[model samples]
Target: MFDVQHLSYQAGRKPLLRDVSLQARPGELLAIVGANGAGKSTLLRLLSGDVAPSDGLVQFDGQPLASIPAAMLARRRAVLTQQHTLSLAFRVQELVLMGRYPYFRGQPSAHDYAVVADALATVGLSALAERSYPTLSGGEQQRAQLARVLAQVWEAELGFLLLDEPLTGLDLNHQHHTLDVARALVQRGFGVVAVLHDLNLAAQYADQVLVLRQGAVVASGVPAAVLTAAHIEHAFDIAVELLPHPSLDCPLIVPRPRAGVGAAFSL
Candidate 1:
C-alpha cells in the first residue's frame, strides 16, 4: 500500500500543499480531482518521490520513500508526467525500451524486448513501434509514454503508477481506453493514482476520490460521497447539475450556466 501522512510542500516560502493525507491500496485506483492550480500535480510529485515534502511522510509498503534507493524505486513505481520533451530523436520502441534500463542496464535481454512489445500492444501503438517519437501526434506520444511507464513496473510484486493529467492530449476514445488500462492494472494488484480533470471519468472508474482546493484537501472518499453537487460547485467555483450516468450508477456532472448570465457569456 502507498501511504501519505500530513504531507505538505512549500515553494520558496509559498505553500503548495497543506496537511494532505491519503492512502492508495494495491488493487485499487485513487483518482485526484480539482481545479487547475489546485496542487493536484504537486501531490502526485510528492507521492512519486520526485520531490520531497516540506512536512510529513510518504511510504510505500511501509518503507519510507526517502530511504528507498533510486534504482529500487524505479523498479517499484513508474511516473507519467503531463509534459515530456525529447531533444534527441529516438524511435518509439527505443523510448519504451528505456523503461527496462534499470533492470537490464545498458544491454537488453529477450525478456526486456518481450515486455516492450507487450507494452506497445497494450497502448495500441504496436504499429508505430518503429516510428520516431517526435513524428507521432500529441495523443500518440502520450500513449507511448504511458506504455513506457507500463513496461517499467510490469513484473513488480507491488507496483504503483503515478499519472499526472494523463488524459491531456488523448481523444475521447483514447481517454476511455487509457483509464480502462489503468483499471486493468488495479486488477493485477498494481496501485494507480491518477490526477484527472474529468469528474465523470473519476466517478466511473475510481474506487476512491480526493478533491483538492487551494492546496488543501477539500474532500476524500468514495466517488459518490466526494463528488456531490455542492463539492463540485465549491471546488471548481462553477454551478453544475449532477445526474446519474445513463448506464453506470456513477454521477455525471453537467456544467450549468451561472444565474443571470447570458448564453454568450463564458462561465
Candidate 2:
C-alpha cells in the first residue's frame, strides 16, 4: 500500500502541490485527474521518488519511499512516463530485456528471458518481439514500453505501476486494452496509479479518483461520489452534464457548450 501524508512540493518559490494526503491499497486502481499543470505529473514524480518533496511523507508498504534501496525498489515499482524517445535500433525483445537488468549480475538468466516473453505476450507484442524499436508505429512502441515495465515488477510480492498519460498515442481499441492490462495487474495485487485525461474512462475503471485543481485536492473518493457535475465544473472550469452510462455503472460526462458559444460555430 502507498501512504502519502501532507505531501507538498515546491520549485524555488512556486508551490506545485500542497498538503495532499492519500492512500492507495493493493488490488485497486487509483486515477489522478486534473487540467494541464494541475500538479498531476508533479505528484507522480514525487511518488516515484524522482525528487524529494519539500514537505510531507511518502511510504510504500509502510516504509519510507527514500529508505528503500535503489536496487530493491526497481523490482517493486515500474514507471511509464508520458513520452518515450529511443533513437537506437534495438530489437523489441532486447528493449524489453532491459527491465530485467536489475535481476541479473552479468547476464540475464533463463528466467529473465521467460519473464520477457510473458510480458510481451501480456501486452500483445509477441508478434513484434524481434522488430526494431524504431520501426514500429507509435502505438506499438507504447505497448512495447508497457511490456518493458511489466517485465520489471512481474514477480514482486508488493508492487506498483505509475503511468503518466498512458493512453497517449494509443488508438481507441489499444487505449481500452492498455487499461485492461492495468486492471489485470490490480488483480495480481499490484497497486496501479495512472494520470488520466479522459473523465469517462476514469469513471469506468477507477476504483478511487483523486481530482486536483491549482495544486490542491478538490475531491477524492469513489467515482460516483467525486465525479459529480458540480465537481467537474469546479475543477475544470467548464460546464458539463452528467448522465447515467448506457451500460456501465458509472456516470458519463458530456461537455456542454458555454452560453453564446454556439453562435461562433454558425455558418
Candidate 3:
C-alpha cells in the first residue's frame, strides 16, 4: 500500500537518508531498526510525507507523495512521531477528539464522537477520557497520542500508518500492547511502518525488518533473514547471540559476551 523508491533526504551538506527504497503491503507490519544517527526517524518522516525527500519519490498507492493535497493526505495517512508535547489544558477526550478534525471541519459530529470514544477504548483510556492531558504520565500521554491518530484516521481506508519510535517511554506491558494494537490494524489491512529500537520486539511483531546503517539500507527482508547475528553486529556495532526462544516460536537475541569475557569472533 506504500512504496518508497530511491528515497534520500539532505540536511544542509549532510544526507540523513540515502537511497532508502522499500515497500509496505496491506496485512504486514514493517519495522525499521538502526542505531542512533542512522536516520530511522528521517526515513519515517519521508515515508509519512511530513518531509519531502531530497531525491526520488515516496509514493502511496502509486501516487507521488508530493502530489497529494494536504487535506486529502491527512484523510488517508496517519503519523505518530516521537516528539509529542502539548501545553494546552485540554481534557484527554478533547485531545483524542482532535483526531476527528480531518473528518469534521472544526465541529465534531456524533459519528466523530463515536470514533473518539472507540479510539479511547482501544487504548484503554476510556476511564481517563475526562482527565487533563497535562496531568497524565508520559506513557499515558503517548497512548493518548496514538488514540488521537486512531480517531483521526479511522475513516481512512487503504492508507499508510507511520509510527516513529512509538515504544519510547512505554512500559513493557504497554509496549507489547501498543504493538498488539498495531498488529490488529495490519490484520484489518492497514499498511504499517514503524521505527523500532527494540530488536526483540521488532523480531516478535514485525512481518519484515529493514535495517539501516549510516543512512543506507544495510538489510531488508523477513526477520529471520534480516536480523541475523552478523547483521546486528555490523549495523549496530554490538555483538548479539541469536538463538531460538525456549518456548516462543521465534528467534531470540541476547547480548554476546564482552571483549575480555569470551572468545572473539569475526562478523
Candidate 4:
C-alpha cells in the first residue's frame, strides 16, 4: 500500500500543501479533487517522488520512497504527468517503447517490444502504432502517452499508476476511456491515483475520494460518504445537489443553477 504521514510541501516560503495524509491501496482507485489552487497537482508530485516534502513521509509497502533506487522505482510505479509535448517526428510505437528504458541496458529486447504491443492494445491504439505521434488528434495523443506509462509498469505484479489531470483537454468519450484504463489497472492489483476535476466522474468511478480545499484535505472516504452536498459546497464554494444515479450505484452530482446564466434560445 502507498502511505503518507503529515505530508507538507512548500515552494520557497509559500506552503503549497499543508499537513495531509492518506493511504492508497492496491485494487482501488483514489481520486484527488479540489479547486484550481488546491494543491492537487503538488500532492500528486509528492506521491510520484518528483519532489520532496518539507515535512512528511511517503512510503510504498512500508519502505521509504526516498530510499528506493531510481530504476527500481520506475519499474514499480509509472507516472503520467499533465504535460504531453513532443515536437519530433517519432512513430507512436517508438514513443511507447521509451517506457522500457529502465529494464534494458543498451537495447530493448523482444520481450520489451511485446510489452509495447500489449500496452498499445490496452489503450486501443494498436492500429496507430506506426503513425507519427504529432499527427494524431489530441485524444489519440493522450492515449499514446497512456500506453507509454503502462509499458513502464507492465512487468510488475503489484505496481502503481499516478496520473495528473489526465483528462484535461479530452472529449467526453476519451475522458471515460482514460478512466477505463485506470480501472483495468486496479483490477490487475495495481494502485491507481488520479488528480481529477470532474466530481461526478469521481463519484461514479472512484473507490475512494480525497477532497482538498486550499492545500488541506477537506474530506476523504468513499464517494457516498465524502461527496455530500455540504462538503461540495464548503470545498468548491458552489451549491450542488446529490441525486441517485439511474443505472449506477453512485451519487449523481448536479450543480445548482445560478443567476445571469447565458443560454441560446429560439433554436
Candidate 5:
C-alpha cells in the first residue's frame, strides 16, 4: 500500500497543501477531486516523489519514498502528468520504449520490445506505432503518454499509478476507455490514484474519493459517502442535485438551475 502522513507542501511564503493524509491500497482506485488551485496536482507530485513535502512522510509498502533509489523507484511507480510537450519527431513506438529505460539502459532486449508492443496495444495505438508522435492529435498523444507510463511498471507486482488530469485531451469514448484501463489495473492488484475533474466519472469508477478544498482534505470515503450534495456545494460553491445512477449503484450529479435563470429562448 501507498501511505502518506501529515503531508504538506509550501512554495516560498505560500502553502499549497496542509496536513494531508491518505492511503491507497492495491485493488482500488482513489480519485482526488478539487477546484482549481486546490493543490490536487501538488499532492500527486508529492506522492510520486517528484517534489518533496515540506513536512510529512510518504511510504510505499514499508519503505520511505525518499530512501528509494531513482531507478528502483521507477520500477515500482509510474506517473502521467497533465501536459507533455514533445518537440522531437519520434515515432509512437520509440516514445513508449522510453519507459523501459531503467531496465534496458541503452540496449533493449527482446522482452523490452515485447513489453512496448503490449503497452501500445493496451492503449489502442498498436496500428499507429509507426506514426510520429508530434503528428498525432492531442488526445492520441495523451494516450501515447499513458502507454509509456504503463510500460514503466508492467512487470511489478506491487506498483502505483499516479495520473494528473489524464483525461484532458481524450474524447468521450477515449475518456471512458482510459478510466476503464485504470480500473483494470486495480483488478491486477496495482494501486491507482488519479486527479479527476469529472465527478461523475469518479463516481462511476472509483472505489474511494478524496475531496480537497483549498489544499486540505474535506472528505474521504466511498463515492456515495464523500460525494454528497453538501460536500459538493462546500468544496465547489455550486448547487447540485445528487441522485442514484439508474443502472449503476453510484451517485449521479446534476446541476441545479439558479432560481432566477430561465431558458435562452424564454429570456
Candidate 6:
C-alpha cells in the first residue's frame, strides 16, 4: 500500500500541489479526479518516485519511498502514464517483453516468456502478439501499453499501480474494457491510484474517490461519500445528478444544464 503524508510541491515560484495527502489501501481502487493543472500528474510522479517531493513524505509498506532501491521499487510498483509514446518501432510482443528487463537484464528466460504471455492474455492482446506496434490502432496501442505495465508487475506481489488518465483515446467499449482490466488487477490484491478526467468512469470503477481543485484535496472517501451533487458541481463547475447505478450499487452522474439554458434556446 502507498501512503502520502503532507505532500507539497512547487515549480519555481508557482505551487503545483500543496498540503496533499492520502493513503491507498491494499486491494482497493482509488481514483484521483481533478481538472487540468490540478497537480494530479505531479502527485502520481511523486508517488512513483519519478520525482521527489519538495516537502512531505511518501511511504510504501511502512518504509519511506526514497529508502527503496530503484530496481526493487520497480518490482513493487508499476506506473503507466497518459503519454506513452514509442519512438522506436517494435513488435507488440517485444514491447511487452521489455517489462521483464528488471528481472532478466535484456535476456529473457522461459519464465519471463510465460509471464509476458499471461500479461498479454490479461489485456486480451494474445491474438495480436506478432503485430507491429506502430501499425496498430490507437486503442490497440493503449492496450499494448497496458500489457507492458501488466507484465511489469506480473505476479511479483506488487502492492500498487499508479496510472494517469488511463482511459484516454479509447472508444466507449474499450474504455469500459480497459477499466474492467484495471478493476480485475485491483481485485487480485493490487492497490490502484489512477488519475481520471471522467468522473462517471471513476464513480463506476473506483472504490474511493479523491477530488482535488486548485492543487488541494476537496474531498476524499468512498465514491458515495465523496461524489455528491454539490461536490461535483463545485469541483467541476457543472451541475449533475448523482443517481444510483442499477446494478453496480454505486453512484452514477447525469449532467444537467444550468438554469435558463436550453438545447433549442441558444444565444
Please provide TM-scores, in order, for all candidate models, with all chains considered together.
0.97, 0.96, 0.95, 0.95, 0.96, 0.94
What does the lDDT come to for candidate 3?
A: 0.89
| Best of the two (2, 3) by TM-score | 2
lDDT of 3 by residue, 1-267 (tens): 778889889999999999989999978999999999999999988877778888987887789888988889888879999998687889999999887887877678898899999999999999999999999999999999999998877867866678999987899999999999999998888878999999999999999999999899989999999999999998999899989988776689998766664445534
lDDT of 2 by residue, 179-242 (tens): 9999999998999999999999999999999999988999999999999988899899998999
What does candidate 6's lDDT look like per residue over 17-97, in tens digits?
A: 999989998789999998788889999999999888989999999999999998998887789888877889899999999
Per-residue lDDT tens digits for candidate 4, residues 122-236, read: 8899999999998999888888998999999997888999999889678898899889989988999999999999999999889999999989999999999999999999899
Give the per-residue Cα lDDT of candidate 3 at 115.
Answer: 93
lDDT of 5 by residue, 160-239 (tens): 89999999989999999999999899999999999999999999999999999999999999999999999999999889
Query: Model 3 clash pairs?
Result: 99-152
The list of candidate 5 runs beyond 4 A from truth reads 259-267
Each model's total of backbone clashes: 0, 0, 1, 0, 0, 0
TM-score of 4: 0.95
TM-score of 1: 0.97
Model 1 misplaced stretches (Cα beyond 4 Å): 260-267
Once model 3 is optimally superposed onto the true structure by TM-score, how far is the C-alpha of residue 255 displaced, in angstroms? 1.1
Per-prediction CA RMSD (Å): 1.8, 1.5, 3.6, 2.5, 2.0, 2.0
Error of 3 at 87 (Å): 3.2
Using TM-score as the measure, the top candidate is 1
